[model samples]
Target: MVARDYGQYDGITQALELVGERWALLIVRDLLVGPRRYGELAAGLPRIPSNILAARLKELQAAGVIRRAPRSRIVLYELTPYGRELEPVVLAFGAWGFKALGDPRAEQIITPDSMTISLRTAFRPQVAAELPATAYGARFGGDDLLIRVQGPELAVTRGDGPADLAFASGPGIHRLISGELTPEAAIDAGVVEVLDGPRILLTRFATTFHLAA
Candidate 1:
């Protein structure tokens, strides 16, 4: 059971009662990208205690926000259709919080999932429309992601795949997205390495994402 009861008469209170638990919404955020095995969820949220993660999963599953499906021999945890409906809410929250973002501490880490979500929150479709369709492979630590921008839509998928451009480093990309560092600055500082793909694509990528002013 959840730790607190908020009376639950008003709709706002009811919703908060259902999702206000710490880490609950974060689980939803991670699953927003796609289904994940327990280990994958844990890896994406490295700081969450194992017991807490299990408990949150159980709570979300009980609330009909998530479901378990057997994939081959392993079970994957995925958001239900109802849970997927939270996309707008999550994205809105991310956008609202973008202005509050500041420099990271030395101990803080950026996970691949968070980076992908940031892209979703900060992507500029108007700017994207000015660029050609391109796929980017991003390597963050040991994780690999495929980021495809076609027309005005952007899709981010985990795992490696063929791409027109490829780059590595999480924080550097974050800096570029947040407009804290320009693409040329990041490259000059040797923070973002272009493993392959056209050099101009990097400039387009930098232009295609910007945090709210």
Candidate 2:
């Protein structure tokens, strides 16, 4: 068993300390999907300074939230089971805070726009059959995003894609598709934006995926 270092406040205090920093939760978010090299984490989280990123990783390691995996004599970060246990915590906080506070910016340091959510939740069809083999860039918000897609797994930066279609509806896409938010509402409120792509294509793309609705 991983020993608990905290005596009075016990393990909870240690865990909170590790994740209480400005950028720590995002580190966990990125790592939750899979193990990541330092550079990959840095690329996804541009706001975190190099030194702080290194420190937060170290802190998580010390607190038993994350561990390093051996890779070609280098190390990549992966969450320990204890770390994975925090997913509910993160999600719960997001749910409650977003509802109660009107705007949940406290933990949401970054407002993930439509493009980010679209890629995250959509069905990634085979790119080899759709677009050219040449690598292309996907820009969400102000930054060029990264995802990786393994044979059956879809990741953003490292994933192989020249996706023939792109959807940029942000959070409303998730809501509309899930039936939590209506498509008409999203369109009328301008909460969703479709850029440089076919609306029918997006409609077809959205319907193809079974997203809990």
What would you estimate as the lDDT of candidate 1? Answer: 0.84
Highest-lDDT candidate: 1
Lowest lDDT 10-residue stretch of candidate 1: 170-179
List residue ranges in candidate 2 displaced over 4 A. Answer: 1-11, 100-166, 170-181, 194-213
Predictions in order: lDDT = 0.84, 0.57
- The lowest-lDDT stretch of 10 consecutive residues in candidate 2 is 128-137
TM-score of each: 0.89, 0.56
For residues 177-198, could you state the per-residue lDDT of candidate 2 as single tens digits?
4545454565566655555444
Pairs with backbone N, CA or C atoms under 3 Å apart (clashes), candidate 1: none
Candidate 2: TM-score?
Answer: 0.56
Shift in Å, residue 109, candidate 1: 1.9
